[model samples]
Target: MATEKLRQANTGIRSFWWWLQCIVSLLLTALLVMDRAEWIDVPGLQRLEWQAYDWRVRSTLDGQSDSSLAIIDIDERSLFEIGQWPWPRTTVAALIESLFTTYDADLLGVDIVFAEPEASHWQRHWENLVEEYPSLASLPPPTDGDQVLANTLSNYPVVLGYYFQSSVQAGDPPVIGQLPEQAHLTTDSLLSLPEPQRYTANLAILQNGALSAGFFDNPLVDADGVFRRVPMLQRWQGELYPGLPLAMLLALLGQPQIDPVIGEGSGVDQLEALDVGGFQIPVDADGSALVPWYGPRGHFEYISAADILEGRIEPGSLKGKILILGASAPGLMDLRSTPVGAVYPGPEINLGLLAGMLHQSFKAQPPWIQGFDLVNLCALGLIIVVIFPRLNAPLLMAVSGTLLLAAVGGNVWAWHQGWVLPVAGLVVLLLAQTLWHLSMNLLRETQQKRWVAEWFGQYVPPQLVKSMVESGESFGLEGEERELTVLFSDVRDFTAFSELLSPSELTRVMNRLLTPLTGAIHQHKGTIDKYMGDAVMAFWGAPLRDMKHADHAIEASFEMLAALERINREFVAEGKPTLAMGVGLNSGPMSVGNMGSGFRMAYTVMGDNVNLGSRLEGLTKVYGVSLIVSEATAKQAPDWCYRRLDQVRVKGRRAPLWILEPLGRWSTLSQERCTWHAAFETALDHYQAANFESAAQAFKELGEEDLTTQIYLARSEYFLKTPPPQNWDGVWMHTDK
Candidate 1:
């Protein structure tokens, strides 16, 4: 019996490893569920999602601007030539007249707010002159510039700009301009939304003259300061004001009525989209829409305000096009961060939004998308949990990489089709799962190798054990039939040797002898089965498969003899008793595996062939040989030299079996040994034929000191004197084991 304890030790480690995998899978699943339920919103994950979103927006842009929109920039040159900002209202009136009458622009929207009327220097001068003269007050106040600008606004289709303020002050700015009658709608399912408390609007003079007005407040600037979306409409004091871009689109669409799509559940209401005429503009639950960037900054054609005022602009440049008036001079501070550029002109953002609306290219992320993300997250996590453990390393990597591509690729395609899908969470989960599995499997295999080495390394060769471990084969230790070679060895006079020494000394002797014997077996790639007192049992083609099992077994037997000789020299030097051993080798089919009761187990071999090997070791003492091999082993190792012993039926069997004494290798044997072998074979043939006198004469000629020859001679003489039976097959029957 070998060390069966090794088999029992592995059960606990394997169980623990399996449990570890389950724990990791459960943790990942929990994380996925938490994120899906919106119970945990990871800031880093959201930030990275926005970053990926920015990249998708940039890469998916059509890079083509709408030709129907134009920007009238009061640029640096306009500031230099037309005298700084807050120019005389007459100059502003002239620019508006050029856009409407001269260029015939279809619709115009201002990104600037006339919150406070310009304090005209001429008015100051006229007031001082009148105060000094006291008689020029009847001169009509030199034509108020505010009235001139207000008159110009009244005659044209211009949308004025205003801003909503969340901060409250002691005074309230006048509410300017009329909002469309259908701008704000409240449904039965909706709740009251928070509205701004304060406003910065135009003077009553400008408000009365303007056709309509909108809030220029972009409430969707992210914490990172990127302008990604604009609120389509905002509430102030229960009144709705459209954003400048939406207001311009409404004017261009002939002031179509606004309608809010409401969805209700659990007494909570949300707006899904806004319907205008036949076009449906989708929005978030908060009524914000994702900006569809056409390209980089400066996408819209800009005509200088000074160029329009001086009539130096090209004719028909603004004709039949929507015009957005804003400032681009660095001093004006109207630049903002956007997906397309970090320092984008604010007016260009409005123009891009308006263009996106006209082309119906806005991206929407409504409430249903959250359900879509949750479904995808759970599905992807399930795939990882189920398939990761079942696949090999290369195949697992391939599956992970394919999933990553599908997640990202599908998200990009959805973005191109105007559907905003959450990609960051799915992509991160795929990558994290792959890395987690990889690291855990590596750690598991490392521990498994250490376990295998601790149990079997002493019995099996290192190279063979390493091969088994790396192959990743499972070894379920139930009994199995396999062709194997078994070896059994015992000290020739072990009982006498033990009787001469104390118990401790006998153990020392056994340790010294068994150490080199074990080394020899392992060197030949055989497994040392176990040691019983002074006897050692070993086998090959077990615990691992060895095609050269028979050859290795024979080689190990020869080495055992050599090791014994070396051991004898040391014992002689120490004035200790010398030792001799007999080894028997047999090759056949046997059952090899972990076998025993619940409390004990043994990874060993058992069969009729194994018993025959033990019987052969006992017969070695009768033949005076150190090594004996059954015919099965001898036939497999043709390159080794052997002397045929005899055909004998042992105590257990009815059929007789041939045995042989293993000599040195065939290539190393001398011609003298070959001649002797031939002569001994002839004598054995004659004896089996019942020629007693001839066989005895031939045995005496060979060697009187040869124990095998003497045994055969004695057998021949005894059989001749007894008178042979009719069915004598020349097979000796041994009565003792």
Candidate 2:
């Protein structure tokens, strides 16, 4: 007998163990599903390096000014007004005369490059036009308009534009121009050895205008190719020369002396810093400046070319103003994509030059921002590894949101204050947290599916059974309390009715009755917790927390009533007794988790709140009502109109519970309901004062359209028939069920 007892005890322990595992698996699955439904939206951390880069550029040139700028727009209007492109050298000459004589422009700068001479056909036509019109003799020589223009440039303070060649090949020579005196001079001859020879610009044009020319090379770019900064100087043929902006600055400052500070290093590591009028500008070892582009495109002043050209501006518009000439024309192919703006205006280089001159806003990289990035990454890693693991869900969410906001806010603040912080890395960090949490949730769900398969196999329908299993525990066996709206519905007199039918017929009728009712509950996203014979117990706002649980329950109640009417109609046609059901709904805190022995666990709710809902269901029939809810449920369901039934203490409860009935069709009966409610309130006051005759008369006068008035009338009649003894406080006791 001892051995037998030991075996039974062991079996019991095993069952418990199995149940615990199953419960744990189910809970984890619930968490996984919740997480999958986007409990958190983790934003990628913006890298500090990129932010710092932005800051440097913004701070350096925030309020700079530009002068001697003119925009030559090849706009649609220009195309329409001047007749398609290649508008003859005479037309361009006319534009130049207008800028010089009419606008009093000090320096003329051309953003347009004369890459190749005009087409032979156009060149011949231009030559013929010049011959026909002797007045056009002042125009630039027309062999190739660019070179002809270049030759004419020597007489004026003209700065021609050229771009740097990024690709190099063997034996290629630099484009011919009047080479600077120290063009081939290198700070370190060995280190400055050209990787390979490369050339830029049309050679003939460069040669013709070599005396007074500048390279229009704007090099500053972000990860996405967009111009934000104009490098002041560049290295070509082992010698340093000023870029267009720097050259313009030099010209503005009377071509001030330029001194180079070279770092003692080997190969491309050798550094150079250009000192112009006390401003020290560092070029990458290769003599390049990555212009810091402000957020996206169009981050600068944009004046229309037509407006400027047509003398639409007042006097002094170009006075001491450093102007830039570039295209905002969409067809110019200068548009670039950027973070802040897509298809940003392509006249960004000219804008940058103007900004640099006006506000001295030049972009530079600061060393400290790199350190800040490392610090940011470490901090995020600590949160993910330490703080996140220990904190509960609410705390975790709060901390994560706070940290993300702080990072983003700090970066934006710094940027507005003219400090560029790298944002890409921070963006990456935030994205990592979001991705990691999602991945972990998916993993947890897979584990849950395995646990569900092991237990509760084939016991319930696949969907319901899966739901039951997925609602289990997390890493450990700890359970949590959640607020849920519980519902208990029962078909009145079902037992008595069942006796009239055989087992087979009873089964068929039961299925027909339950199917539609269950469908109504599911429509409101309520889960069926369990079904006792002829009764259903369901709950909402758990498994998933729905803010609209109260509304959903009320809506489901009305729908269920409608469904019952249809069922009853069928029953009447078949000569079967129609059925009536009562539903009790209450919202309160309950412990919802795995409950039972190890081998036979169920995901269900428990507590006094759950019990109260079931007890209220039983009182529905006694009150002659189809649906009843506690005061708590009625108050929570603000969207639905409810009529108070009475204050009564249910069995096993000490305090009186305020009961309510779902006022279906209340919207349609708005005016009538108002009158009936007012009459019911008066009747309630009189009934409580033991004035049964007055209360009965008031209730009867309410007419019988609304259910609440009918119920009050019935109560008054019952109380009058069996009047309470002396000292009775007029509270009616409902006993029959």
- Number of the top candidate by lDDT? 1
Tens digits of per-residue lDDT for model 2, 262-361: 6553232345455666655645444554444443344454455555556665644554344455666677765665433466554465545434443545
Superposition error at 544 for model 2 (Å) = 3.6
Least well predicted 10-residue stretch by lDDT in candidate 2: 190-199
lDDT of 1 by residue, 288-405 (tens): 7788788887778988888888889777777799898999898999999887788999888888878877888888875677778888988888888888865556677999999999
Summed over model 2, clashes come to 55
TM for every model, in the order presented, reads: 0.69, 0.50
Per-model lDDT:
0.81, 0.61
Q: In order, how many clashes per candidate?
A: 0, 55
For model 2, the superposed segments whose C-alpha errors exceed 4 Å read: 1-272, 276-281, 284-484, 499-502, 546-551, 587-591, 607-609, 638-649, 665-668, 699-723, 734-737
Model 2 has an lDDT value of 0.61
After TM-score superposition, the amount by which residue 271's alpha carbon in candidate 2 deviates from its true location, in angstroms, is 8.1
Error of 2 at 8 (Å): 26
Residue 295's C-alpha lDDT in candidate 1?
Answer: 86
